[model samples]
Target: MATLPNPLPSLATSGLDLPPGTLVDTTLDGTWHEPLLWYADGPPADLRAWSRLRAAGRPLGLLPVLVTGGRRDQWPEEWDLCPDAASYPGDHDADEVLAGYWTEYAADEVAPEDTGPGTDGTGPDADGSEGPGPWPGLAPVPAREAAEDADTAAAGLAGVITADADEWLGGARTALVPARRSADIPAAIGWSGPMNHENDVARLCAVLRSWEDRYDARVVVLGFDTMIVSVGRPPGTIEEARALAAEHYAFCPDNIDQSPPYDLDAYAEKAVLNQEAWSFWWD
Candidate 1:
């Protein structure tokens, strides 16, 4: 895969302010030829650590992300990461990848048991369209009327994860990945967090890049099979929320199918509408 020059090897002697950390090269296959990321040796106890670490890495082309060990102690090294399987993010088109996933999964019959409260056993959703309908296409970029600074939003959510982590992300540690932007952190480290949903994570990163441009979203926290993103600008109305919901569904179906209110409208209302952060889990 094409990549920017990895500066991890030079981090130790680079004279940049940094906390003690470990350079990780372990992968599912074996040791990688080069280090993928560097993570602090301790938990992120300070609320400002995320922003501080991000600032330190920005000049060196390393982006900060929160890595979680979860309750099971499944840290990054044990996550079965497969950087080798990933292609460059630039190689994929977000709309194409999302549209393909939409076509592939949108038509599956929603089993009666999967239906949620306020949802009919079978019929049109609040949006007047159902899964069997044509792909809704991409949502237009929303106005940044209620937006926060992207990094500030990320830091705030980092504080939330640090304060409330345990079941999902309490084991948060600040980590830095060598990448040009926050959206590419997953693919840069060869994260396999969503392998079950999509084998090549760079494809998902492309969608993230699109979101970064449209919504000022940043990759915040990553666990073994989950991720949290901080959104600067969220949908202002139910109409816009439902449209964005289709993109989220295409990105990660579990955010809808396996979530409560097993339909687009409710998921949009609860998860995507006016929310500053979004979380996803794979099965």
Candidate 2:
């Protein structure tokens, strides 16, 4: 992946109020030349520290994320990161990537038993398979009539996750990653958590960068194979939610496919519409 000069190497003298931490440079192939990220030795005590770390990291072009050691006991050290396989986020366009995925998967999800004719309608194809006619396309950014700041909302959600450590994340650690933005965190560290869905993570990061502009979204928490994105401006109407649902479906199919009662409308209502956070798990 094309990247900026890594600042993690000089973190020790950067004058940031950091806790005892471990700089990780390990990858699936072997040890990376520079540290991929720096995670705290323990879980964050409260939201204040999370906010502080986020603020401290931003000046140095480092983005803060809550890294959880899940039930599987896989931390960043154990994660099989593949930086070599990733690409730069700026190299790909968000719409094209999402459109490609929607075309490949939407037919299976939206098309049902012999339904109708038009694009949105269901119908069988030349291969004798059912599908929705065409990709629904991307959703427009919801107007921020009274939206909260993205970082504030992210910190609030992080607070909730940390407060209920026993219930949610096994142990949440604050990790400072050298990234251009929050959306690029996955590609920066070459996180392969969603490999089944998208092999080159930078492509997914492209869509995330679009989300950051449209929804005031931030990548807040990441476990071994899970993610939680805090959305500051969510869809206010079902129309908007449904449109956004197509994008979500393309991004993570398990969110709708493996989920029982597998319905797009239901997924939009329960997971996307006006919700401050959207969580995903790859199986």
Candidate 3:
């Protein structure tokens, strides 16, 4: 068979540089009415807003949450994103699949050293008590596998490996591709609407206000259509989460979706193939 062209550039081997963008890291300690938010591009950390939120109540560890989808035929536990797990895929396993994909993306791109002990902007020797530092590299495991590993690993030092709402899972087909591409920059540049493509900016604002009152952490960055909030370990209930989603509408009034249900997975797959900066994740 003719050798397939290199699926994509390896972030590790490639000399590509991260385009100029904002970067923020914050902790989440409590619950918010509606906390889900996405931006075109601001800081790299902004792309990880959901990851930071799910991390609440979770111990610091190396668990990688996957993002998969739920089909009517497949129950919540029957997702087949992973080849060796339940021997089948389930509806709830979408997150697991997407997360696993992210791990591979990072391995191919992000340097093993950049995410370890001294790499984060927190400054080397900053955490005070430390030794060699966090793991140098992350292994992408299926959602079930990751959860099992997290329960076994006690440090609570888990990091996230997920996809935005619309990500594709082509398995080996994904090995050679990069999570993002530069060709789509023109479309993403010079924002003309709300974040996450939602039209409701005020909805987001309202969510933020509610979350702030309920949580005891800081809300550091708030863009026209994005937010970066913090919290500790114990997050609030699911009710508060809804509020956060509502608050998001405050920032972009049209953020809500009234269209018929669409295939987010298919969309995600195409996005990865294009290798373009996701308008949903960028500032």
Candidate 3 lDDT, tens digit per residue, 1-283? 0112221222223332333322111112222122111122222233343334334312311111222221222211221111111111112232233233233333333223323332211113346632222222211111121222212221121112122222222110000111111111111111122334322222222333333333322232222223233322112333233222222222222222221122122222332112211112222
Which regions in candidate 1 have their CA more than 4 angstroms from the true location?
109-131, 144-146
Give the poorly placed runs of model 2, Cα more than 4 Å off: 109-130, 144-146
TM-score of each: 0.90, 0.92, 0.20
The deviation in Å at residue 31 for candidate 3 is 40
**What is candidate 1's lDDT per residue for 105-128, written digit by digit as tens?**
766834344333321122355577
lDDT of 2 by residue, 124-217 (tens): 5556655655665678777655367888989888888888865787778889999979999999999999988898999999999999989989
Judge candidate 3 at residue 140 and give its lDDT: 18
Question: Best to worst by lDDT, what's the order?
Answer: 2, 1, 3
**Whole-model lDDT values for every prediction:** 0.81, 0.84, 0.23
Among all windows of ten consecutive residues in candidate 1, which has the lowest summed lDDT?
A: 114-123
